[model samples]
Target: ASHAEGTPGQAVAKAASAATPLAAAGGANHGARAMPGNALPPYPEAAREDGLEGLVRLAVEVDAQGRVSAVRWDARSGVMLLDIAARDAVRLWRFEPARQDGQAVASTVRVALQFRLDAPVGWVAQADTR
Candidate 1:
């Protein structure tokens, strides 16, 4: 539901499309990380200054090339800065393209990204959106 580094609870996601059998079948990959987690966006100055924290849900479309082709705001954090930050960062994210019947195809999936600033110093919470 929500994930924060140095804090409890982890990021989670749900399928946004009922017609997306590929996505529903667990064929969706959230990020293109070489390690484990999704890329965390840099904290927006406004959000940091305002001490804002919450979750932003996004509907991301990944092309066959494994690149983000489009992103839509499915849910917002109620803070404009946080929403914008999520959008900007997600647009640059790459994915392990969805395939159907052994063929790469564009697919849409939903992701929930949480942004939190309550952690101690040097322990920044990252956002994860699919």
Candidate 2:
């Protein structure tokens, strides 16, 4: 069943297939990329209804010792308040440093930050220990 001419759903499938590469290309041009082929969990209805909308793309420079040496904006969200907050928060984030070939290498990352103007999810484990 495709939607092209007499097809029932082939158009939908084709459109979806075409979109993947285009999205990756678009993100690539931004010097960072979204996660590959991983379907993130769908947003909850509460988050949608509460106007919780914020996403910031970051480019982190990984040092030789697998540490974040610096972070910069790959894409800005237009909201200075949110952007500053996200930048500040991302500095505290830890990650498995990127590698090229075999040795640890510096790489940029694109991350999304979604904020919920709702209840807290509780204390962060590392922060609790500290």
| Best candidate (score: lDDT) | 1
lDDT, each prediction? 0.56, 0.39
Pairs of residues at least 3 apart in sequence or in different chains that clash in candidate 1:
none
Candidate 2 on 24-89: residue-level lDDT in tens? 344222121222222222223444465554455656564545455677877676655556665675
In the range 53-91, model 1's lDDT, one tens digit per residue, is 877787777777867788898878898877887778778
Candidate 2 residues lying further than 4 Å off, grouped into runs, are 1-52, 116-130
Compared with the true structure, model 2 gives a TM-score of: 0.46
Model 1: residues >4 Å from true position, as ranges?
A: 1-38, 120-130
What TM-score against the true fold does each predicted structure earn? 0.64, 0.46
